[model samples]
Target: MEIIARRIATEFPKTNQAVGVNIVSLVNALAGQVRIGLLIFLGVVTIVLLIACTNVANLMLARYAARQKEMALRTALGAGRLRLMQQLLAESTLVALAGGAIGLLLASWGTQVLVALLAKNFQIPRIENTHADGWVLGFTLALSLATGIIFGVVPALAAASPDLNQSLREASRTAIAGPGGWRLRNTLVVAETALALVLLAGAGLLLKGLLVMRTTAPGFGTENVLTVDFSLPRRLATLPGTPSMNTAIVMTDRVRFFDALLDRARSVPGVRSAALVADLPLGGGQDSLGFQILGRQPPPPR
Candidate 1:
């Protein structure tokens, strides 16, 4: 009777070992997927920020044109050109700082909505911990400052220049005499339009790629199908025993739980045949095993 009991114990452990490994692997895969998704989302946000900076720069340039006469009068007075430039730069910085403050408030609210949306779509673990951290705020400030400088410098210099007096006088004359000012404004418009077109083309390509991916065949019948995952605590995963008794216990519980769930599902009316699988089809990871092919050997003396 002791021999029979021992054999039964050994067989039970062997049966349960495979189930535990599958559960742990699935959990790890989900964690990796969540990390990747977060990175992609951040990348998209950075691109949108660049486009916004370009638009803001164009608006500042327009304002600089309108204020050219005032800047010229200031220059004609005791105000040094460098001092005017500094004042214009300071104004741009103030505008950027105000925008950044508003953006921070919006981002705080947006992040909560984003987390809730992700949770509805994916089974992410511990999503409450995801929030905008110090690095994000620091980056936003740096980006805003840099954008202010990039768009402010050229317009400020032009406005404060001595030659701008003649340009402003010509602009105040008949439209035919405003050739130089008109040309400058047209050039700025062309540049902005070209950049916008390039961005639009890139966005179009990305949208097309996403549409293609969505329409591609999944190669599986997903009608009325659902998936479940199980995981063991890290501390209980490893134990000192021959053939790992801890692994056996975890795997047995997972397999039995899934088996009972499947049985209950199948007992419902209009249900079809149920099959147990060790892994999901078309899942995120590769399942590979070392093997020797029948009647074929490796290359000789390579």
Candidate 2:
């Protein structure tokens, strides 16, 4: 980028301007405008994932409690503790893997839809070709396994070491959860709720920022606005088969064309106004040129 900037600087006829060269990372250049919003979204999604894992763990605990009698009976029938735990863990993993499969399907479609929407909103050059690929598949598989282990461990431990005597004795007395289980579940719920509230607060702040941006003045009137694109003919623009047009010649022609077009445009009934600009504001960027004050030291690069 710095080299390109220097090359463009050399193209200028004026020697009065001071030019500087700089380079920026492509990813940073592309994502800079929405970096904050993207970060907020990522944080919120991470919190949501944590909340989900906690909720799922709580559900697994509930399932373990409900099957207390069955687990105790299995223990009585000479089931190994390791075997019992493995069976419970396997069930939890199975559920997670199924969910992961469904999520992969959703992501495959969502990537295309998201890219299309981004292309419609922004002028990003390569926005519509994203898809769930190998890295995404690997991430999904790893996340599913990790989620299963995180949420299933406690329940598996509880099921594996069921107090054969205590569980069997109290199995018929009530269907309610034990005090310890309730305590654990309550802790997880509290944590989930706290994280959820944090996510909500982040979302609210992001929305507020967007609203402020929308309301802020953009330094130009947009009401009842009409815009059009203009281009010169092949000969005027200097095609390879045609003689090259000098800069002065091209500008003179371009100005004449716009003047004629503007007159015609204004003549149209109900047309308010017509104008032209080399580049639009809040558009990508204007071409840059070097400049120096006539009687001062060169200013540093911005």
- Top candidate (lDDT): 2
Give the count of colliding residue pairs in each prediction. 0, 1
Q: Please give the CA lDDT of all the candidate structures.
A: 0.69, 0.79
Task: Give the TM-score of each candidate.
Answer: 0.66, 0.75
Which residue pairs show backbone clashes in model 1?
none
Off by over 4 Å in 1: 1-47, 119-129, 162-184, 228-255, 275-278, 289-302
Task: Write model 1 residue lDDT over 125-150, tens digit each, in one string.
Answer: 87867898998899879877887877
Write candidate 2's Cα lDDT for 170-205 as tens digits: 855323266766677788889989998998887798
CA RMSD of each candidate after superposition: 10.2, 5.6
Please give the TM-score that candidate 2 achieves against the real structure: 0.75
